[model samples]
Target: MCWKKRFWFLWNARLQPPMPDASKGVGHLWNHNALKGYHYFEIKTIRSSNMKRITTLAFFACLILSISCNIYKEKKPSQVHPQLSPLEKYVAAPDTAFRYELRSTLPGKGYTTYVLYLQSQRWLSEKEVKNPLWWHWLTIVVPDEVKGGTGLLYIGEGSRKTELPTAAHPIILQSALATHTITAAVHNVPNQPVEFTDDDFGPRVEDELIAHGWRQYLDGGGTEADSKWLARLPMTKAAVRAMDAVQQFCKEKTQKEVSRFTVIGASKRGWATWTTAIADDRVVAIAPVVIDLLNVVPSFQHHWQAYGFWAPAVSDYVREGIMDRQNTAAYQRLIETVEPYTFRKRLDLPKFLINAASDQFFLPDSWQFYWNGLVGEKHLRYVPNAGHSLSGSDAIESFVAFYHAIVNNEPRPDFDWKTADGNILINTDPQFQPDSIWLWQTANRNARDFRKETIGTTWTRSPVEFSADGKYKLDIEKPAKGYAAFFVELVFVGDGPVPFKFTTGVVVRPEEMPFGDYNTTK
Candidate 1:
C-alpha cells in the first residue's frame, strides 16, 4: 500500500501585500487574485453590477469557504493514519509488504531468487505512503539437499545479475552452507531519485533519517533537517527490517521456523552485523570481519597502522565540530550511542572474528581491549601470511561448521594457542599431530625460501619437539624484520585419510607484541 501513494499539491494561493500605514488604520490587505490580478478585476467588475450579481457572489463565497475548510483539515500533518511495514505483511498475510516482479529458480541449484520491491517503513509510518521509492531485494533459497532451519542474512553492496537487476548477490549461500543456506541481501538505499522532490520526506526520508549521528540519535532525537529533534538512524533500522523479512520468508516458505540465525558482514557492514547481533536475540552468532571499532577512547592507538587512514566516524554528527576531536565527552557520547562495544558485557552469543595480522584497515593489536571485553564465546582468527584475505579463506568453512554445530546441538572446535618461554604451546587431542610448526614473519609472508618437492623442510622447522603433555615447543630465534605469526601445520584433512572432524590449521599471535616485533614506528 505504501508503494502506491502520491504526494503532490497545487499552488493557487495569493501573497498578502506589504503594510501601508498602521497610523491610518490600514496595515495590510488580504488579496486572493492568485497573484495574477485576474480575480481582482473580476471582483471589481461584479461590484459595479446590480444587487443580483452581489447575491450570486455571496453564494459562491459560501461554497468556496466550505471547500477551503475541507482542504485545510486534509492537509494537517497530525491526523493519524497508520500502516504496516514490509515484515508485518508476512505476519498479517495479505501481500501488503511486497510485490514480486520475477521469481525463478537457479539452474541445477534448486535455489529460488526473487526480484521484488520492499515497501519502506517511512511510507508505512507516515501513512498513505506519501514518499514511495522502489529497490530490489535478491532472495536466494538454500540448495534442496541441505534444507534446514538456519538462516544467514547478508546486507551489503555486493554484485548483481541481469535477472534480478540489483547490486546485491548471495555471498555466503554458495559456500559450505549452501546445501541449506537461505540468504537475503538488501542493497544500500538507492541514490535519492531525481523526481522525488521532497528531498527529506517520504521513502526518501529513510535514507536521510539518520541526521549525521550523535549519541542521542541512537534511540532516535535531535534538531535535524526536519523539526530540530535529532533524527532516527536508518542504518540499524534498515538492517533489522530486511533481516526480519528474510527470517519470516524462510519460516513461511519452508514451513519450518528458522531456529538458528547468524548475521555476517565485512567492514562497515561488520559494524551492522555486530549491532544486529546485539539488537536481535534470535541471532545465535555474529561474524564481523576486519572492522574492529568498539569503545573508541581518546588514548587508543594503532602504531603499525598507516597514517591518514584514521578518520573519526563520529565526525559525521551535525554538532561534532562544535567540540574538538580530543573532547572526552564527545568520544564518550559516541561510545554510548553507536559503539557495540559499549554493551559488550551484556552479550551472551557466540562470535567469530575473522581477521589477519597484516590487515591494512585495522591492526591486530588494536582489537585487544574490545575483543577481550566481549562476554561471548569469542573466536579471533588472525591468519598468518595473510592480510584481509581471511574473509575468503578457511574462515568461511569455520563459520558453517560453527553454525552447523549450533543448529544440530553439537560443539564447535577450538583453536587454542598460548606463547611462553621460547615455544608456542598447542593443546592437542593426542591423536592429531601437526605435520610441522613454523614461525613466520609478517614482512616475510611474501617470500620464504623452500624446496617444492619436500612437504617437511628443516629450514621451516626451528628445533620444535612435542612433549608428553601435548605442547609443542619451538627453539628458534625471532625474525629480524619485526613481526611474527605462527601456525601449527596439521596434515591436510581429506576423505578417509584424516581422523579429524571440523579441523583446520590453528594460528595465534601473543597478547602483547611478539619477540623481534615490538612497535618501532616513530
Candidate 2:
C-alpha cells in the first residue's frame, strides 16, 4: 500500500462513519461479554424511535455502562471490602495429604523486615545486603482450625489496608480458608522519576514493578527518583523471599515441619512470582496472572507495535535500548543483573498461568511464548474476555484450586509446547473437538491504539490441523517474516453450531518458533 492508502486507513479508522444500513429499521445487537459475564447493549440502529421510549431506554443503557465500568477498577484498602468468613470456612477438616507443622515466632513489634541477598549476580554491597530492598511483611496464620502450614504468599502490589489487617488478600481476604492463610506483604522498591498518567498504569498501586527496567537511566546517571523498578533491588527481594526466606518464615511460624509453599500474584507481582520460582527451587508451584513478561524483552523488541510493555518507562527493553543487540558491557551487566526475560530460558516449575484474553495493558499476541518458556509442569487456564484481573466470584476459588492441587501433589496432566520438523505441536489435556488457533497481528509497529484496534486492526485467525488423539499443530507457510504477535490459541469447536470464543493463549514470536517465518511474512 502507498502512503496515501496508509493515511486513508488511519483516517477512516479514527473517523469511521455509521453503518451503511443505518437508514433501515432499528437493529439491536445483543453482545455478550463472556469475560465480564454480562449482556451489553450495542445500538446498531436506533431508527429514529419514539421520543419518550427512546429517552427511557437511553437512560437504562447509560446506567448499565456505569455499573460495568466498575468491574475493571482496582479495589483499594480504603474501599469497603467484604468481611472475613468464619474460621471453619477457610478449609475442610484436616486432610492428611496437605499436612505440616506450625512453629515460627513473629519478629518486630508490628511488622518484620527480612534481608534479601542477591545471589544470581553480585551488584549488592554490604549495605544493600543488610538493608536489602525490604518490604514490611506480616503473616496471618491461624493454626487453630487447620493441620498443615500450607499458605498463599501474595506480594501486595495493589493493597495498602493489610499492613496490620488480619486478612491476607486485599479483595479476597474473606474467601481465604481457615485451613489456609495468606502472607501479605508490600514490595518496598523505589519509584520512577516519571509517572504514567494512563488509566491502567497510573493508579500507582496496581503495578508496583510494572515499569521495571532502570539500566538506561541509572547506568548513564540520567535521572533516578524512586519506583518499584529500582533495578536489582526488586529481583533481589522477589528471588530471596520466594526461594528460601518465605518458606523459612512459614517453617518458623508453624513449629512443626512445613512443606513447600505456593506463590501467587498478578501484574508486577506476577513477574516477581516467575523470578522467585526461577531463583528458588523450593516453590511447589506458582500461579501468576495477567503479567506475561517472561520472554517479553526479546519478543517486544521485534514486535514493538503489538507488544509495547505495560510499563515502558522502566521496561528492560526500553531502558537497555529496545532494538540494540545489547552486547555492550553496561547493557550485558544490566541484563544479567535485573532482567527477568534474561533467565526465562531455564525456568522449571509447576506454573498455572491463569491469564485472560484482551487484557488492556498487554497485547495478547506478544504473550505467545509466555507459557511455552516454562520447562516445568505448566497449565494454561485461559479466562475469556477478562482484563488484567481476570476476576469474578470464582476467581480466587480457581486460584485456590490450583494451589491446593500443587500442595497435595495431585496429578497434573502434561501439555506439550514444541516445534518439531516444520510443524508446531501443541498437545493439551483431553476434552476438545478442535477449531483453529485465532492468531492476532498488529497493523503498525508503533504505539498500538488498543482502544481503537478492532478485529481488522489487531486480530487475525489462522486455521489449525488437528489429529484424532486431541493433539493439534499449525504448519507455517514457508518462513514468514516481519514482527507480529502469533498466539497458539486453541479454538475449541463443539457439536452444535460452532460458537467460537478465544481463551488464554500460548503467545510466541515467529522468529522464536522452529519453522516460524514471522520475520519474512507480510
Candidate 3:
C-alpha cells in the first residue's frame, strides 16, 4: 500500500483509545506494521530534509496519539484466562460459515443505520440440520459523532424478521450518539421458536431450548460434545460473529477496525453476555441485565428455598426433568461446558450486573450465590420497582451511563459491601461520594416469594445517613411474621448523561429456610 493509504489505514486502525503499552510510540506502530519500515530515526531524518512534509506527518501522528490518550487514558486490555476452550471452539468453529449482506440503510436523526441480513453460523451438525440455520438481522447504528476503534454490541431477542427494520431502535441510536461509538444490535439470539426434528422438540426459544439441551444431555445419554451444541453455544456465537461482522463492515465502510467492545444483553441475552465475555477477548466490559441466576446449581437451590417451589419463570427446566438429574455426571459436564459460574475465573472484564428487585424469574437475593466468585471490577443494581421486563424504569439510562464509562475509561465507584450479623455494611471510598443513599425494603408476610405479581408494588425506600463511625449501615430486624428483603442503594450522578446506581446484594431477614433443602418438586 502507498504511504497515504497506509496512513489512512493506520489512522482508522490505531486512532482510537490507546491500550496500556501505547506510549511505546512509532517503534511499536512499526512492529504492528502501522508503519512497516518507519521508525523515530526515519522521522528525524525526514524532518531535517523536508520541513513541510515532516510537519504534516508529525501533525498526523500527534493527532492520533492525542485522541487515543483522550479516549481511554491507558485502558488495559481484558485479562483472558486460558482455561475455557469449549466456548472458544464454538465461536471459531462456525467462522468459515459466516456471511452477511447489507440489506438497507436508513438515515436517522444524528445517525446513519445499516441493516444487514447476517447468517452468523450454521450450528449443530448435518444430522441435526432439521433445525433452522442460525440467521439474524444485524443492525449497526453509527452516529455522526462516532469516532473510535471501540463499539458496543447488544445481544437482543426476537423471532426472525424477514423484512429489514424501518429504523434503528431508539435506545441504540441514543447510545451511539451518547457514547460517540458505533453500536450494533443483533436479534434472534437463539433463532428461536425452533423445532428440532431429531430431538422431537418443537417451537422452543430462550429457556425452553436451554432446558431441552440440559435434558438431552442428562437424560438422553448425550456426551459432553452434544452438550456443547446446546442453545447457548449458538446464542453466544451470534454475538461473537456479530462482532466479526461489525468489524468487517466498519473496515469496508470507513477503513476502521472495531478492536474492542462493551457488550450488553438482557435476560437470556444477558446470560449470553456472560458467555460471550468468556468466549471473546475483545470484550472490555459487560452489562448483564436481569439474568442473575449464575452459579446455576446453588442459585436454583436458593430459588427453590425462597419460594418452596420452582417459580413459574423456571418451569421450562422443571418440565424437562432437569431438576431431577442434577446429580448425574452428564449434568455436571453440561454445567462445566455452559454455566457462566463455572467459567467465572475467565471473566476478568469490568461488569455491570443489573437486575430487577421484583424479577419473576429470579430471587432478589440470587447474587449471593455467585457475585463474590466473579473475578473483576463489578457493579450491581436491583431496580426497586421493576421485574423481569424492567418496564417503566430508568434501567436503560443506567446501561447507557455504564457504556459511556467503559468507552471513556471512567473509573467505577469504589466501595465494598457485605451482609454481616443481620446488617448490611458499606464502606465507600473517600473519593466517591453519592448524590443520595436510600434503604429499599419490602415485606412478604404470607410467603417467602417477592414477585411483583404476588406481592404488588409494596417496596418502599427511606433515606439513610452514614453512622458516626463513617460507615453506611442498615440494621435488619427480622419480621415478626414472615420474611422481609432489603438492601441499601447508593445513587451517584457522574459527569455522564445519567446517574450511576449501585447496590448491596439483597438480604432476606430472619434467616430461616421455609422449605426443605434442594427438593426435586414443589
Candidate 4:
C-alpha cells in the first residue's frame, strides 16, 4: 500500500476502538480498548519475541470490545492547500491599479495618528508598455517633536476643474516649464487634522500644472481624526514604513530604480516636507513655504486649540492606556529615536524657501531662522505686501522665479529699488543737544544741465531726512534722475555744533532690498 493509504488505514484502525463511544454508549469499553490498542500498535511495530508476545496479549484485550460494537463511523476527506479566490488573485497581481487609503491608530484621548497611503502609477504607452513611475511616500509630523504627540490634521482635496480660477492658469503654465511635476502636502499639530485637503489645495496646485500641459495626479484627505490616531503611533516606525512604501511603489511602477524626487509642502505641511527630507535620502528637493520653526511652544498651543473637540476622548484613552505611564523622559526618548532620521543636512538637489513678509502664522523672521540652517543649493524669496495666504501676484512671481532657477540652473537676480537717477541730501544744524530730537530736511537735486547750470539750477530736494543722533528718518521724495540714491547721517557732538556725514548716492531698486534679515550689519 502507498504510504498515504497506510497512514490513513492505521489512523482509522486506531480510531475504531474509541468509536464504540456513540452517545456515551461505550464509556469504559472505549477507554479500555483505546489503551489496549495503543500498546498493541507500539509492540507490533517492534520486531522481537518479547514484542510478538506483548502485541498478541494487547490485541486480545481490545478484541473483546468488538463484540458490543455494531455501527460504523463515517469519515471525511481532508484538504491541505485551498484554491485562490478571484479577489485574492487580483490583489496579488502586479499589474493592477489601486487607490490608496489611510489607516490610523489612536493611542491617546487628545491626539490623532495616521498611516498615509503611498500610491504610484505605471507609465502605459505603445512603445513602453510596462514602464512605470515609482511612487514616493511621506508623512506629516505634528508638533513634529513630542512623544504621544497629538493634534495633527490634514485637509481633503477639492475638484481640480471646479476650484482653480482662470487667473491662476498663467502661473501654473510657467511653473510646468520649470518643474517635472506639481504637488502639495499638508501639516497640522499632532492629533488635529483641521486644514488638510487634496481638492482645495492639491488639485489647485495640479490645475496650475495641467494648464501648463503636464499630466497630474493629486490625492490627499487628511482630517482631524486622522491626526489623533497618528499621534499615538511611534514616529520612527511610521517614517520608515512610509519611506519603504514610496520606494517600493516607485520601483514597481517605473521598473527602474528611483533615486531622486521632489517634496513640496506648504504652511504646516511644510513641516512634514522638512521631516520627510530629513528621514529619506531619495528625496532630491524640498520646497517648504511659510514654515514656522522658532519653537515648539506655539505649535503645541495651536494644536490644542485646533483639536479641542477630540481632546476629551483622546485624553481619556491615553489616561486609561499607555499614556499614563509616560513622562518627560518618555517623550525625549521618542524624539531622540526619530531625530537622527528626520533632521536632514544639505541635499544634492534644489531647496526653495518661499514666504511672505506679512504671514500671519509664520512670521518672516521664522522663515529666516529655518532657512539659515539649511545647506546645499538653496534659494529664498520673500514677497512684499503678501500675507499668510500667498496667492498674490508678487508671491506667484517670486515662486515662478524660484522654480525657473532650480530647473534651468539659472541664478536669481539681486533686489533693486530704483527707477531713475536722483540725488538726496540731508540738512544738518550744529546747534543740537546730544539727546535732543530735531526735524531734518531732504533735498532731491535732479542735475538737469551739468554743463552750464552747476549749483542752484540743477539742485532739487529729494525726499530724504535724518535726526540729530543719526538713528531714524524717512525718504519723503523718490529719485528721478541718475542711477543714484542718497541718505543723510547725523553725528551728535554734545549740545553744540554736530558733525554730519552726507551719504554718497547709492542706486537701489525695489527688488534689491533683502527682507526678513533687517539687521544685516549687526
Best by TM-score: 3
Clashes of each: 9, 38, 0, 73
Point to the candidate with the largest lDDT: 3
Model 2 bad stretches (over 4 Å): 1-133, 147-149, 158-163, 170-213, 216-232, 238-257, 305-329, 344-346, 368-373, 391-395, 417-468, 472-522
TM-score, cand. 4:
0.33
Q: Which segments of model 4 are wrong by more than 4 Å? A: 1-174, 179-259, 294-349, 367-371, 409-522
Candidate 3 C-alpha lDDT tens digits along 190-228: 776666666666677778888887777666565645755
Candidate 2 vs candidate 4, TM-score winner: 2
Tens-place lDDT digits, model 1, residues 60-103: 86556546534543542322122422222212221122322223
- lDDT (CA) per prediction: 0.42, 0.41, 0.74, 0.31
Off by over 4 Å in 3: 1-84, 199-201, 220-222, 466-470, 520-522
Which has the better TM-score: candidate 1, or candidate 2?
1
Q: What is the clash count of model 1?
A: 9
TM-score between candidate 3 and the true structure: 0.82
Kindly list the per-residue Cα lDDT of model 2 for residues 225-299, writing each as its tens digit.
222234434433433433233444334554433344567667666766665555444456777776755554554
Q: Between candidates 3 and 4, which one is better according to lDDT?
A: 3
